[model samples]
Target: MKTTSITHRLADLGGAKWDLHTAARDRSDRGEDIVEMTIGEPDVALPEPLARAATRAIEAGRTQYSNGRGENGLRDALAESYSARRGRCFERDNVLCFPGTQTALYAVMQGVAETGDEVLVGDPLYATYEGVIRATGADMVPVPLKAEHGFRMQADDIAQRITERTRAILLNTPHNPTGAILRPAELEAIAEIALKHDLWLISDEVYEDLVFEGNSFTSPLTLEQIADRTIAVSSISKSHAAPGMRSGWAIGPRGFMDALLPVSETMLFGNQPFIADVTEEAVRAGSTVADGMRQRFAKRAQYLADRLEAETVLRVHRPEAGMFALVDVSPLGMDCDAFAWALLENAGVAVMPGSSFGAHLQNWVRLALTVEDAAMTKAVDRISEFARSVAVAAQ
Candidate 1:
């Protein structure tokens, strides 16, 4: 049997991107003491209101096939949420629901790009981004996100790389791996370029709810001039600590929705009604647990940065939002891969090498901030001690 090139390009459905983390899990399953910081998943349980909503929907016989786009309630709820937040007049017609942010992004890529087309994405982006773009037969053009800019994509850099083949710009805010949120001015400049080039702006905003106290999350869709060309995808996975629910949606121009409805149906007709009901509750009532997560993750990030700066050769780049922080390990004279693997093998600490995200992160290691307070304290202590030992060995 012949297979499509997508399978080869997907790299075993993107498992290759997480090989280190997978190996750590394998060891942990064998009863090793690995403090797994390799994944950015929320540690909290699903909010009670959402859980109750799903159960009630199931008990009330809501387990039927939904429409091609999505259930009206979830769509309407999402529309309302976006409208209120962005100050834009969105309707159900502008919403298309998928199981999660991953699927929504895949569909958007398929809609805006294809073979011979180039989609401009920031380097060291979310790990699965490479697969989704490649799966659409589009080349992902890496726009270097400079560490000096706190890893945020600069509009000038984006403009410099705009070739005629460029068809779309894929953006992740409160970005994965780095957790740097784009400022409104930067977003406005980028949006203007997208308009000037007549390219689609695909914004991945899944972590919008987890922003730290002093920072705010901005979306290109909020720029009124770019709304017609901008498509934003999000979910309750992080906000409600409900990743398993797999309820997500995209809000974009009506024309894009009109064209993408078939693509959405072709993949899967629609999501489960029970899940839709749960999602509707999540979007409408909002997540009470997100505030708590904001406090914990932000606290851990500061603690990680302060401890590393005070006690070791390592340096931490604290995140404005999201569940991960990057630690600079170049001072230890080891690449991030060597540093991460050695930390796991000798110190029982499992963190992701920054290179796994992309080349720009080659000198850094990213660690999840979702562990309990005591567990996180112990992990940081181990990392500090490991960093000192590595530095001494180099000395």
Candidate 2:
């Protein structure tokens, strides 16, 4: 008799981070102390305004299903807020809200590319991107982000990789793992490449609101030439510390959004109205909360980088924004996966191996600055000791 089988795309995908997270959780359940620095979740509390707004909506019975494109009021607020940030006017029709940024990204990929198409992505990218691209049946073409250049995706590199089959370029500013923020000129250059190749630009700006003092956040929508082809995906998850709310949206050309609506409908039907209402309030009034969290994360990133540099053999790549730093642990004479596993087993600390992001990052590890100061300090101390032990063993 024949047996049911999983699709090749799904079978080929790997969730290394989730696997490590589960391992860490299991160890903790067994009474071992585990300092989780594997995921990019914020340690901050959700802003009171968001919570209050959500409660008000729920009490007022605003729990019905919203339009697939989102409620008009929330879309209007997002349009106004994002227009101000991107320097481009966006109408309500330009937005499609999803349960989360991950869903938004997947829907956009499905709407833009089909099977046999190619999408260029930066190496050392967020791990889920590969799965999403594969799920859409589009081949993910990796454009190497050189560490020598701080892992910033160069426009020339993108231009060099484009083929007739290339449908889009996926970007994450203030990127995960590396936390390298793209400069305005770099964005402009990339925009030009997208225009030249007639390719779509999917810019994930979830970390836009978390930028540090010196760096500025520029949206791909700002480029008038590529505005029509660019889809800006963002959420209040990282910035407002509201991941559980699952509020996120994609802003693009109305035509593209029209095409994406069915995908969102099929995948999610629609987001909860209460969540959209809460998101609207968060967008309008939660800047102070977001700003305070960003400042704290920036400080935490610096503190962790400083500690790693002084205490451990790892070379830290201090991020300009976002909640993670990439540390080169090759000095310990082991690959990143080995180092991470050993650290988790021996030191009770869990960090993501850089190879989980991209093959080129095999000798690196990503440390999330989401833990409290005391825990972060203690985790670093354990990492330092582990590094020293490995070095001594090597000698």
Q: How well is each residue in 1-395 modelled by candidate 2, as lDDT tens digits?
A: 65333267766566545677789989989999999998888677787878888899999999987777898899999999978887889989999998889989989999878888999999999988988898888899999998888899999899888999999999999798788888889999998888888899999999988888888877788889887899989899988899998889999999999987888888888889999899898888755566776777788788877877887677888888888888899888889889989999999999888878888799999888888888888998898888888888888
lDDT of 1 by residue, 29-64 (tens): 999988989987888898777888888999999999
Model 2: residue 366 alpha-carbon error in angstroms: 0.7
Error of 2 at 249 (Å): 0.4
Provide TM-scores for the models: 0.98, 0.96
